[model samples]
Target: MYVPPAFKDDEVESIRATICSAGVANLVTATADGPIATPLPLFLDETEGEHGVLYGHLAKANPQWRSAPTGEALAIFMGPEAYVTPSWYATKQETGKVVPTWNYITVHAYGPVEFFQEPERLLEVVTRLTNIHEKSRAKPWAVSDAPAGFIASLLRGIIGVRIPVTRFEGKRKMSQNRPEADRIGVAAGLAACEKPQDREMASLIPIPA
Candidate 1:
């Protein structure tokens, strides 16, 4: 997460928004064997500690949970991103010095990792995670919808994960380093793209007053 000063995003609200909107994260840890990572759907509880707390689960068979991490774990959350062509830069025509780059929003959260197997805690985690993702559905599903025995049996195959986030490094590389005219051109170009993600990224580019 090497972020230049121009692209740094230190605002708490902005960082939190990126994390929440991401819906999923890459959890990485260093082990004696090597580094291990798992893509997980994680939730942030902003009310928890100084920074926040992250919650998720992993399959019981996954070795990542069993390995002892040498240091802090990292959770990487990625937001909208798009490829910026040098052709979109006004400087390209003036001096032909511009090069292609990627514009994206990302957050790296670091903290101690905890894995638990208690059935009660696992059930609570599963129920909350399910509700969060299902709330937008027309007829939302719930853990209670399934039989207790069935849900209990399923929970046995998974382990819970908790991380009390100690720090956050957020970056928003959205053409902020470009000149006003170049940034406008990028925004226009991306907005006209057929990809919805490119169009979404267009709105994040800063426009000069």
Candidate 2:
């Protein structure tokens, strides 16, 4: 959350891309007892409000839904990330002043939280969520694939969540603060690594003009 000016990501499309690509988020809420969080697969509804709405579900047994929230809820979405060794910085060879750092993208959405149990709404939320994730499959599955009674029974064990996001905090730390040579070294180093994520991160590093 302590995003420096160089790392701040305020671009609307960039923020939305990070959220959508994250696929899952950590939903957190402050309560009288304490803070509670749940890792949830959430989707953004850009049509809903000024900042858009977030939708997800939680198991009925999860106490996070039962506790009364004291303030706005926070949903954290994380994107590509990789460790950057000082060895990848040209400054390490030139002046030996560079230290290790991390490159990553993240978004934090905050808004009022609402929990609902209506079977119809629950069904709709789950169906839409399922379709979003399954659409890429060779044979995409649908809620209609299952028997009505079976689907209804399963829906009873979960509760729906909705958050009309009031604000968003996005950060993209991709070696933007480093010198051009150091950044190039980082990109090359990461691109050559075996981890696919590191290679993915390599492409996100900004190339100096």
**TM-score for each predicted model, relative to the true structure:** 0.98, 0.98
Going through the candidates in the order shown, the clash numbers are 0, 0
lDDT tens readout by residue for model 2, 158-183: 99999999999999999998999999
The residue pairs found clashing in candidate 2 are none
Local accuracy of candidate 1 as per-residue lDDT tens digits, 1-209: 89999999999999999998997899999999999999999999988999999999999999999999999999999999999999999999999998999999999999999999999999999998999999999999999999999999999999999999999999999999899999999999999999999999999999965
Error of 2 at 104 (Å): 0.5
Candidate 2 backbone clash number: 0
Q: Which candidate number maximizes lDDT?
A: 1
* Model 2: per-residue Cα lDDT at residue 99: 85
> lDDT of candidate 1?
0.96
What TM value does model 2 have? 0.98
Candidate 2 local distance difference test against the native: 0.95
Candidate 2 at 57: error in angstroms? 0.2
